[model samples]
Target: MTSNDTPEPTRPVTLWAGFIIMCVGMFMAILDIQVVATSLPTIQAAIGVAPDQMSWVQTAYLIAEVIAIPLTGFLTRAMTMRWLFVVAISVFSLASLGCALSNDFTSLIFWRVIQGFSGGTLIPGVFSAVFLLFPQNRQGIATTIAGVLAVLAPTVGPIVGGWITQTYSWHWLFLINLAPGIVCAVLAVWLLPRDRADPGAVRRLDFVSLILMALALATLEIALKEAPQRGWASPLVIGLAALSLVSGLAFVRRSLTAVHPVVELKTLMNRSFAIGCVLSFVLGIGLFGSVYLMPVFLAFVRGHGPLAIGTIMLVTGLAQLATAPVAVVMERRMDARLMTAMGFGLFALGLGLSAFQTSATDFEEMLWPQILRGVAIMLCLLPPTRLALGNLPPSQVPDASGLFNLMRNLGGAIGLALIDTVIYGRAPVLGREIVARLQAGDVETAQALGIPASVFASRIGQPADAGTAALLTPLVEKLALVQAINEAWAMIALLTLVALCSVPFARAQSIASPQLQAKAGH
Candidate 1:
């Protein structure tokens, strides 16, 4: 475990096999988020939950997942990677079955919570393997595979979920996890390298720290979820926010002073790692914001079906896959800081271009923006990962990886809240202005809206023409929503550009490559 000692090498066959299993598990975990998202309407109908309460289907999973993310470090130390993956995948598969069979909202949320906790560890576990299991020479390729799954799952989730829901029952959405989860569990048990659990690590779990950590994250998640709907000033939202702040401070103090904290708060002291965490947060904002915004635009504004929306979104994932090999090659030879800068620059460009879109924009118009975002995302992920974990000693890799991934989810939670605030707050004002202009008989506005001159004349003295008003109301609402979405896109572009400032702060060390070492020795 000492820094000076060389860790034992993993067999290539075992290493690659274990990595593939990890990828499948990680993909399922991330995929479930968006997959269930697209199917929530159907699920709500089936379970008979009120519309307002249906949001909990997604919220419960996210809150549980966020709480479980930082616990990976402690769990890995206690259970070891091999047994942990087996147990986690098993629990996830069984929970998936439970979710599929649940008849009511309460049971579904209970199973979803279990599913989230089990799947949460799989994400950080895969990243930890990048530094823990692979030799320096193969780390780039290993990371490429893991990165693709991490980003790709969320990209294609709607497509897969939509197809499943349209073709089969909503039950199949959860049922889909069964076979893959089982396969991943078996492969992990058979191929992963065995290590003994550290009994000392198990005994050191700070129960108070665990309680505070859970309270802090859960309260924060609830506060954000309710803020957009309940008003940020509502007593419930304010109370939760205050509770989260208090619990968060308590958790930080306890973790820093505890003999063996559940999460190692000290990882933030590494300058490069800290910068990497910030970049990951900004990336999450753009990533989740775009994903959430697009579907809303298509479904509400364009009246597109789930299948059609999924089809359009697939363009982003295709572009990412096409760029993966090129990103891998760049990781081998390029300065990571420079690559990261270029990545965020392109991402910002993409978001900025989308900000100019009109209500008439379609898949054809979105092609280039999606392409730019797809290529930029891989660049965003790979370099920051190396910068954060590349030089850490083996003992710190797991703890650092957990914290790194947590920042991204935390960013997604906060980003989604902000995006909702913008949309809900701005749309009504825009709608009122449009209605007022039309009511005042602004000729330019009438012409722009394509209302016939005859119809405009006919309604001159009438009480706003009930039928015409009914037709125009929906159109005005759609136009207002489109503008609101454009504003959200602009905000994301600004965030992505802001991420560029942190690139230079990353450590300049190249990832270790055996060939480079050999050449230097010669």
Candidate 2:
């Protein structure tokens, strides 16, 4: 009954069952992250938190992730995967319950950080385990399935969140995690393989490297988060940036010397893997940057409500879900580099389409590009991930996957911080310029200038009844803000295109497992 290493790989029913359970866990984790975003206003009121302090819920989770990701490899080797998973899920689920029951923001944020640490376990473990479950030839398929979860979870998260937020209290968002978390934990105990941790691996932990990485990532994350509010040169911001630079350098030095490192620096030495990481960084910028920008744009510029904004993004999410199968099918035959290029290229094109938007642009106009973006994302994200780790030794898969995700997540943090700083910084200047050009009743200039003056006045800026002399000026200001945001999307598109260049260097290989061969042959 046991499918431990044998000459012929036996189908592990338990592995497939574990995959199913992990999918649910993945769904809950991603759903909570995004779903609660739309529900934040409601939660802030329910918990009586001020707007300035509300960000802690997300900050706590992200900080926890930063701390947990590098430790995953060491942890997996130190504790049996099954027991580790059980403990992680148990903590995450209980944290969810605590969140649902919490009466104040401080208490909620506390449980959220706890949830962050526990929830961090699902990704690398599920992905690495899935690779182990399938035979070698089917790794592409396994990875694809994993990719679908990656893409779909964030997409469906908001839709589910919207429905729950509208129907139940915001507490439901936190409560929802409990069911899946408990189920995933139980399944892990029942069907999952309990691979015991080797004691020899415990001695290999690079404590200094771990500290340096945590510090580097934490400082960088803090610097990025603060940039949007406190201009880049703010002393607090500048100091964190300096600390991040020093820590980043220290981590690199330690990783090279440490007998056992948190990250396998040699794996990154592969040209393809390194290049793939560059694209991943760019992909992170687009994926996460857009998630931050679009809703803000839609709500502030387009005058959409939380439900409406959620609905619009739900389209992109659905489109992404639709594209997953195609990516899965195509990766099997096509070189991953080509697929990565295609994805980035399409994403670039989609970004270009977004730049053309104005206050007059309607939902349909946005949908087409979203569809394209979704397809492009699947193309860009999956292949690079596949190529990045494909050439590494089988034993290195977990560590590589952890590093890959860590880099991408870090890229996302950078993107959000940078884009927000750029857009928010430029908005007032752009708004003033637009006002100068379009004065009210200057029909000749507005008509000849191709301004949607009426739409702008109604849709953008601080809503107000203005002086007759400046009646149409707000219209111009609104368009300018909208245009500025579009410009941001354009920047992301160009960045994604640039990321495509890295594809040429991706290594052309995949990890092999004999069990995979036996299953396929059977």
Candidate 3:
């Protein structure tokens, strides 16, 4: 039976119970990555991995997750959403336990792959339920819950990770997932209604397409991750990039023609859905980029610890929570396109404001921009999600949800790569220029850098003593790095503003299915 025709629980409690469970699963999954990121140094030391090899802990999970995301449509069809959630959460829980118990890097990486694959499905699964289970009127609130979890998990991950690692140990990061994973799994089985699995769908698994998709995404993620350190032109990076491109093209061609495609790329033909996907991609860039930029800045520029960084970042989350109700109200009453435009505009303003920051900038200086971003991220997410999947038929929802979510992740990957390029590429050049100006007797620059006139004169056209050069070197590097970071923030803002042009392409009205509207009316 189609999703609309499937029987839903008559009681509201049961429906929402199942949904909350799903959200719990999704929240845990997304939160896992960030929490691990915050505690990686400890993890690396404990696991005895080289500094260079340490990134694989996260990279392995990311590559696996990216590959699994697109396969959700097929998996949901084969196993049914209920069983899928049950199995995914069970595996995720088991994987978490395995990770916590791991004594070696190899075992940790293995468990992380399993954890990532299982966790990946939870993301699209939660989104698919908006149309599959909820009525049109309630979808705004439903979307709000999902969007909040989506935005909130990353926002608070560092805080939670910091507390766990600092107060207890790094193992708690994985051990913590055990309770929620089990609880979510049990709740799914008890609360979610069962649907018959499609045997035909299971039989039609496109192995070739799956392999190509996996290779494409895996290589792409690795390439992006390594490009910054290895140099984009390095043979390893170039080979991976070429492999990703070829595999990606093959996956696209195969999915288009295959009778039982893994992903539903054709959904992009719908103007609204297509625009929503674009918006999702751009939002990913801003959301993930900003999240990345903040912690690094606080850690390196300001020398804040993880707990402090996470605590300060809470401003954005608090702002998001405050604005969520407003987003819910607007989703019901306002033009999604207009709401989206407003969101991107405010988010850009926040990002642009952050671009002007100095090395000394702190909580007070960042408060307003954090509030703007906190409020704006929800606006950016809620409407675009509704616009993308609200109108798609049940059969299409899974595919569309997977692809839509995939865009956000892809945006994060691509955005970070570009941001890194800007930072690393520009910092040295700017550093040299600033040093040149200092040598050229720019009085204001000298005064601002706290360099004595005699010292400046001594350094002119000659290498100064180690003490003077040491002081000046660090100052120059800090200034140059901050400038580069500002450029990155500005670039993100411009990209966000550019996303505004696509808002007009989204349907102005809610496109929720008639059945959903009818159910809401009842």
Candidate 4:
């Protein structure tokens, strides 16, 4: 048996205890990322920060995650895996407290950067821990449980934040992190194994690559964030985008040739890892893209409050949490390809349903889509995670896990920016098109087809009164705008389905049977 495949000594605590601790860590991290999203307006008002500065709250965390994630291999190996978890939890918990007490945006952003350093390690560390804690046969179940908890944080964060913000204060969003973060810290220390650093291990510490990656990702993130507000072709935006691409390419070249790469090039060369990276990127597009678009769409079109939107999303988050066990069972019964495809199909369907939304649609209409998403996410996430690390050399698991999650978070940041630019760019044009058609008696055309004049007029308005029609035009025009958003959702759905096509290229790996373990001299 591989060192990784051996079971741990039976202790008073069960494997589930590790899962619980990991979940608490994950919940705190995810909660912090999103809970602040719902409270940004309040935060800005409280601190008297400019709107542009408010974006830094999110940008700082994401930048830190991006900067820290690619370095996990070095970090994990330099310190043992267990100490990494303990340190990460302790740092994240302390930062959450600092965030709660921060009197200004600068202070909050500074602590958030600290939080990111700790939070960034948590996912890869948690995944590595699961693999270490469980035998290969049970990896699927372990990963599935981890995936469910990971998904739970983002889905529930905003909902919980909204409730907390509305009922108490926006400061509570950061305050809420403190209790869970401390719990996670305590559990991590008590339950997790301590690390033993390899003093002789190579630590490349490439100053140039680190700087390039940070600058490239930071520039790209900034460009994406600003593209919607300032046109993409604007001088500042173009300069940043160009710098991002050039620096990114330079880093890629440097990383590939470096003796001790910050990112392990060889690991990503594996077909499974390559496909997994692609899948993770696509997932970023879907996960963050929707999160960016949906709440704003609901608020603008249907006028829902953050609390109401959060409530609906809470149900979805709970559904995701509930599916963890089922996903674990399914992983054993199904092929990675089939399970991933089914998951993507459900996710696409959810996004597809969202494509047709109108302002008049009730809150209930959104719930089912979110439910479908919960299912799809659980299905897709577990299998890829299993497939990626299932066959890796035990020593390389930490690197693989780190790269895998880095793509997801980077994808989230970029994806949100891309989708936002698209909707903002297209919605106005679509609105105008509908307004023009209605003024031309697309209604008269309807009336000519035996639809009543009153019905046509009530719906699309009289073609003759151009000024009045123009004044009331947004009502009819918004349907077209809604359809444009649907188009975006449809594209995301299709992208998920397209991601499934990569599954054929993935290597098929079977779990080691318990019987096989017994036969093999266990």
Candidate 5:
């Protein structure tokens, strides 16, 4: 084992406190993405960005963020976790401040890239802390704490953003990170364990590997971003995808033979860990995709504003909160594989329920599906976490954790792209079908669009005039959108089921209980 296995130990309470603070820091970073997402239109208008260019704000952040995640393991070694958290949080806070102060889109996006790169470290850092700070018995409790906040941010972000946007200005969406970030950074410095930063390790860094990895992830993120809008066959998207693939392969080859590779590629040889990563990737697809899918359907099909969409989505968040304690308890008592199966099964079922949604399906129809997904959140996370990181030696946990988290993000990018393709590609064809049916005086189609029978009664035997067609066009579009979104829901549901099938392939990993470790120490 490497020197990383034997960490600087502290009192139990202090260690838990430090970990909690790190979790909070991670929550802030994650919440920032979703919060800003819901208010992007408002921010775009305020910053004087043209509509077409606004997607860059989010794209810039995602590209920089993905490039930084795997590098966290190296940074933690170069500068110990305590100092790294301090430095990253400080930069993130300063960037947030800069974003708030920026009057133009260019300045805002510049700060966003910096913010994302720094914020990316916060996630894997906390997961690494789970193994580094706590013993195996307590790791479940720790994972639950971090996992809840990780998923909770996206669930609640829209509402928070909507409330802030509606009550105050869009600037507060970013400025909200300031106070908590400063306080977290200061506390992390004092409470977290520290080790000496290595000066010469910086010299050992392989800059070529670093550049290749960054290019690969950056180009992949951009390619995924563009593929849905410009078809995957688009020459620009193809070139970007090819570049990402080539760089990724070269980086892998270089990493395997390097004197001191940036990331530990050999970690995947562990069967449980590799399968656990697949589970994480599938979870990312469902987690981020569902969160993304709901807002789109609610906003576009139902015409709900950001606040209302957030409020409706709150059901999932509330259900998750209520079920967290139960998940923690079950974690200590059950077989992890069994828990993973149940979690993904329930999550898939939840996704499937929405597949039957009609255009008129509203609050009552959505409640149960959201609750099922919420309750499954912890189940989906804690078991796979144990299966993945619990088997690794402490020395490898940092790098292993980075790769694990990165898989989830990569899954989210790919899943969202697929969801968008389903929506954008199929909507027009479905729209045409609905239009043709409506022209034939199909009452069922009209009723599905929430148009009363009386409204179409007089026009049943006649062709619709231009005015009538114009009036019905928007309703037809909403109907088509609802159908397309339902298909997207089913698609993710199938993906989650595939995750469930992989669960049994993960062999059980043994972890010593805290009591056993204490006696051994004695």
Candidate 6:
């Protein structure tokens, strides 16, 4: 016998306090992902991690999160929404404590993996509540509240992380979660309904499907990370990619055949939901990729510290705040498909604008692009959300929500990998070009890189000394880096534009699915 999600009719919930706490819990979880991002160097030194091993600090959490995200519906059903959230938050908080207490790299990574697995469920969990807990008229407002925080946490993470690291020890990053976590947990138990956990559900769990999915997602994430660094053809990268593909295919087959699938793989067959997932994927690339790109350029190319980069990043977050209300209003009145197109068009334009950046590009030049992406983010989120989960029957929303949210995360992971591939792969080639241009006395090229005319003249026709070559190396590297960054910017911008191709095919979705309508007819 398979698991069915249909619930007995219950009174509509107005548990505002519990719901708010739930959103806050989700926000904290999302925020921590980025909070640690800007402070990785401080963390690396404190934990005495080697430079080569440092990326794992972030990767471990991400790989775990990616694997866990799709299991949200399964876990929610087994434990019930109320208890699952409590358990996840408790574990997440304890993991935070463990992360703060770790004295070595190995221990920190261990805690991070646990932290990510628990935290991953919070995102889709809250979104599922929007449909399950609220009526049609109110879902717009609830979703906006959740969406703003969802996008906002990541946008503001750099500033928050930078401030925390600069003001106190890096341990404060994780320690900050302890109080909030405790409070949220207590409030959850008090305010949420006492839905009994199903011991039978746990017993019937499909372990084979679970293992396949975990292996597939984990290997896929690690492969994405490795491909850019080690080259796509590297043996280790190829093996990981192959393993991921095989396991992923097998997982799909198992889910389709199994009586009690861990996740609802059939959710992808819904046309609007599928398109919405694609849009979500594209949004993730632009959203996470932009956030990722801005910091790298600032820290590496512009020689800015964490605080300064955070200041510059504030533009995106501020824009997101200002436009959120208007977006909510528009989403109610407009056709979701048109709104989606307009949002992606502006977003693509925003991304395209950054592709022309030079080594000298900074906050002012970055200002408009960030603002455009920021304003566009609300549209990207609100409409696609409605398209994806809006029409699903209440019973199916949790599982569908997990799959919808998963696409965005997977997009972020893949986008970052491609961005890195461009930067690391193209930089050296461009660096050699810059060196050749400099050797051939191309002052125009030098001037474009911010070298003054007089400075170019002074260096021309001079015998290259060790000091001169040392002085020139930095410039060549910076020029190459900015150019490669711009190329990557172009790559994602085009991908965003390409996503628009699918919007035309996405039929406008009604508030309720046909299954719900049929049930209502009775």
User: Which candidate ranks first by TM-score, i.e. highest?
Assistant: 5
Q: Compute the lDDT of residue 333 as modeled in candidate 1.
A: 82
Top lDDT prediction, candidate number: 5
Worst lDDT 10-window in candidate 4: 1-10
State every prediction's TM-score relative to the real structure.
0.95, 0.90, 0.95, 0.91, 0.96, 0.94
Cα error, residue 322 of model 5, in Å, equals 1.1
Tens digit of lDDT per residue, candidate 2, span 1-522?
111221123346766776677766755666678887777878898888998878778888888876786566667666756666788888889999999999987789899989887777667766666555565566666676676777666666666777888898888898887777778888778777656465666677777787888788878888888889988999999999999899889999888877778777767887877887788788878888777777878877778876677778877777877887877778766777788888888888988888887776768888888899887877887678767766555566667667777777788888888778768877788776655545444444465335466854554444446563376566655676777788788888888877777677666654235565445523
**lDDT of every model, 2 decimals:** 0.88, 0.74, 0.88, 0.76, 0.89, 0.88
lDDT by residue (tens digit), candidate 1, 1-522: 222222245588877998889889999999998999999999999989999999998999999899888998788887887788889999999999999999999999999999999989999989987887776667778888999889888889898999999999999999999999999998898888777677577676799999999999999999999998888999999999999999999999999988888899998999999999999899989889989989998898778988899999999899999999999899888899998998999999999999977778899999999999999999999989988888788778888999999999999999999999989999999889888887887766565466787777667656765787898887788778888899999998998898898788788975547777334322
List ranges where model 4 is wrong by over 4 Å: 1-15, 199-203, 444-477, 517-522
Per residue, candidate 5 scores C-alpha lDDT tens digits across 321-386 of: 899999988887788999999999999999999999887778899999999999998999999998
Residue-wise C-alpha lDDT for candidate 4, range 100-182, written one tens digit per residue: 88988779889999998788888777786666666655667778767877777777776787889889987788777677766
Worst ten-residue run, lDDT, model 1?
1-10
Instruction: Superpose all Cα atoms of candidate 1 onto the true structure and report the RMSD in Å to 1 decimal.
Output: 2.5
Off by over 4 Å in 6: 1-14, 194-197, 454-465, 510-522
Clashing residue pairs in all predictions, respectively, total 0, 4, 0, 1, 0, 0
In model 2, where is the ten-residue run with the lowest total lDDT? 1-10
Candidate 3 root-mean-square deviation in Å = 2.2
Q: Which residue runs of candidate 3 sit more than 4 Å off their true CA positions?
A: 1-7, 447-463, 510-516, 519-522
